[model samples]
Target: MLDTTGANPFALSYNKLMDVALLLRKYLPHMVSFGMFARVTDITPKTVEELKNLHHLKLDSINIGIETAHDPTLERMSKGYYAFDILEQLSKLDEAGIRYNVFYLNGLGGKGNGVASAIATADVFNQLHPCIINIVSLTIFPESQLYQEVINGTYVEEPEIERLMEMRTLIDRLNIRVNLLGHHVSNTVPITGALPDDKAAILREFDKAITKFPEKELKAYRSRIWHL
Candidate 1:
């Protein structure tokens, strides 16, 4: 039931289940776990309600990519929607009784604005209170504007240690109880736990690294090709 259309709302092929769901229904066991990808942020709440039928088929999870909380960053990334739009769509999903995970990116704004981007993203996650929060560090792809800027000497990459410090600050400030998943390769250090328990310990690890690790080593630790 994963909607593998990336983040495009209009990319949805139909209002209801397509042939894939039918095929899965035909061969898969009734109680088997299933998940789907959908850009809940870009579509109207009505479109999300259509997914209510998924419960009839026994869907276990859904994942949405809520890249950043800053509207300008989203527009620059071409995510096709604003932060509030995503919040509205997530609320609708909750009302429909569908469980979902949200993905957020750190260091997306690069050096100058990276810290603010992390803070804004944390605010959104606290508000949504999703089942899981997947945090990933920003990576420039060869085909993306970020990549071009890097090649042309216009983009200065953020050090891995600074990024980790920003993330540590974010983790320290989160008030909700959702699980934090930092398993992505872009992340310099990956740890998972319920907030306010291991949360302080996790942030402490990064804080120590910030003070102990040298600039070059930190940069090397943070550089990676994976997105999430």
Candidate 2:
């Protein structure tokens, strides 16, 4: 989220990396796997290649928060990249044979814009091709910029059901071969399944979730269900 341009100026030198690599090899002879949460903007092909060279710490996967593909939503959340920059960097990771997971924040777009945000995000996912896509609903804690926005009446938090609809929209719009895991502490409903293979099933599950609330009380339920 810090990097909008996908560039890292402060990378560890290859010799310094080799020093750490030697220590890992000497201490853990049997260690064969490693993973990391990385900023998609900072991961270049060279970074992937460097990780691949380290035999003891086999970097196989990375986790990144793509937030939302909609630029305004990203701007709203302080996530620094746009859809094109994200796609380009993820493409680099793919070309370097690095598998990765993406995290999407539901309700980040605020109120009624969830559907638009989900559609835009799904459009990018189709091209970016993450191994897994995870979801988390927004929770505005105190002292953050988002919280400040809420204080100033600049942002209206979406209701829980609306957030679920946003998640469903993202699930419905995806046309890629990726695992969709919508389990998070903040999520109202847990939506977990594989894409393409479980698309229809997930849709059914979403429909059930939507219909669970009686249509008559859904509007009022917003104030009753989850605290903003």
Candidate 3:
């Protein structure tokens, strides 16, 4: 229940006085038991410290959006920080002994650099070792810069199977253990598991479908799900 965007701007700033009256009146009862806290990025480092002061505040988890490990891809996507900067922030969070979840976008490196992006991302996650890693495929939204690229033929979306393969490959290479959650609407097949062990098996299942299943049968299966 961390609010990455809120008044305090950093998770550590949460305190009794910050918004005591309203929080107590509205959220305290439901949140107290689960240790809910919000993470606010887009704030200065100094402000981040102010937020960290609330460590005594009970929070089950904090979530942050790291986006991508490739700097160029992040720049193209107009994200605020570089890959190293994200790593540093995650390191700081780790040092504080705060559990966190990280969000990453798939197919962001487009065609040529997808593998590189995947590998770089795995390296970062392996280092940070967040409690959860949420892998999501890119969906073209009309207002986004990425959408413009797709419209102009500058960027192409990979087929669902290809995207799954890329993620599977990346997960296969990770050395650390973290829960992987891929339940976004853009993902054709939802996957959830801890790394290294389940990754290869899931990938193999998808590979079999892509390689052996007839297109007609696959379409029928997809159609049934869609209709249901």
TM-score for each predicted model, relative to the true structure: 0.82, 0.80, 0.74
lDDT of 3 by residue, 68-88 (tens): 788888877677677787777
Error of 2 at 208 (Å): 1.8
Write one digit per residue (lDDT tens) for candidate 2, span 1-228.
111213232144645646755765677666564455666565543455665564234545668877889888887767777888888888866766657788898888998889999999999888876999988777776757877888899899877678778888888888889998876656656778887999999888878988796544544543343553
Give the clash count for each candidate. Answer: 3, 0, 7
Candidate 2's displacement at residue 21, Å, is: 4.1
RMSD of each: 3.3, 5.6, 4.9
Between the candidate structures 2 and 3, which one is better when assessed by lDDT?
2
Q: lDDT per residue, candidate 1, 1-228, as tens digits? A: 342334343235544444555666877655465666777543463554465665456554668877777776787668788878877878766766777888777877667666777777777767765888888878766778788887888767766766787788678768888888987777767778877678878877787877887888756654545443
Off by over 4 Å in 1: 1-14, 18-23, 41-45, 141-144, 222-228
Angstrom error at residue 8, model 1? 8.2
lDDT of 1: 0.70
The numbered model that scores best in lDDT is: 2
Clashing pairs in 3: 2-38, 3-38, 12-51, 12-52, 13-51, 35-59, 35-60
Ranking by lDDT: 2, 1, 3
Q: In candidate 3, how many Å is residue 2 off?
A: 8.9
